[model samples]
Target: MEILPADLQLYLETHCDIEPEALKKINRDTYLKILKPHMLSGHYQGRLLSMLSKMMAPSRILEVGTFTGYATICLAEGLTETGFIDTIEINAELEELLNQHFKSTNVEKKIRLHIGPAAQIIAGFDGPPLDLVFIDADKKNNLLYFALVLEKVRPGGLIIIDNVLWKGKVYGDAQDTDTKLIRELNDSIAANPQVEKLILPVRDGLLLIRKK
Candidate 1:
């Protein structure tokens, strides 16, 4: 899904936020121990997420996919003094590793990891308005996820959707199920009048939607 050339991507990471020692350990362990380590937003993207979080300094953050807690910790770096980022991971098996890494970063107290389908938790949530949201779970549910969180996000809040490009298939003629789902979501976002959006051609793609 990496559109950038290898050398350029490497250079960007080198110049970006020095992946902290704790985050470095999480990155290394994710590659060595987790399946499909590519899904664990690595150095460059993690730094971008961190930078965005720092800029927002949001008090309520929601992350749909908490793969190995890599991005989770990154987002936690820029929370309000009393802020918390609630994340959902469907796979219960990774709970142990997720908790271990979260603890290692000492951000466990700032993170609330929910184990189960994201739709349930998001739809039932009655917490304060969210200022930031990161959606990186199942591609098929991207549209549903967006809809569920839109009402909860305060006006002017940001909802960042990862992998909106679906490895460039969304723009291609590939009519595969996943690509079609992504395309539908992208088109819907483009047509929606309640928000303004942009697709940053980063790793895969990130569609940033800011509510009006």
Candidate 2:
């Protein structure tokens, strides 16, 4: 769900750095082939994710969702030479598409695709200190993922949570399960003392939390 007005979104995209040719192709293919094309990070949010990743210059990154591998590739933009990203996707069906997308990319060597339940993958993860994490998976498990990720993220590391606004349902009196869970997670994160957090109204809404 686009939180920004269409014209405003277009203006923002126009002003931001141009989307890379590889990313543009992925965006086009995603819309043509994916079931929920909106889930793709698209142009603006993809640039934001890339910018954040570039800013962090993390040695190790964990992404909880790998929808179409758009954001996966974006986040890889700023990884150190030895840095690598471990992105998990529950749908094994997407593995082929993701692999195909990563095959010719420069970040291919820096990406490790995991096809399984994010919880299980994260629980067993024993990688180096995580410098950053991106959570864009099941809304109900947002807190669970946050807690799990917080344990592995080093001090001062960052965790990015997507869809926190849930297309404006979070502010309305929508009693739906996803909305309630997202609202609860939002409240919980805001109250948590372990990290400093801020929500950016980009795309659906991205919550950036830095471990303290």
TM-score of each: 0.97, 0.97
Query: Candidate 2 has what TM-score?
Result: 0.97
Tens-place lDDT digits, model 1, residues 105-207: 8678999999999999998898789999999999889999999999999999999999988778998899988898899999999999999999998898999
Measured by TM-score, the strongest candidate is 2
Error of 1 at 47 (Å): 0.6
Model 1, runs deviating above 4 Å: 1-3
| Cα displacement (Å) at residue 166, model 1 | 1.7
RMSD for each of the candidates: 1.2, 1.0
**Deviation of model 2 at 116, angstroms:** 0.6
Clashes of each: 0, 0
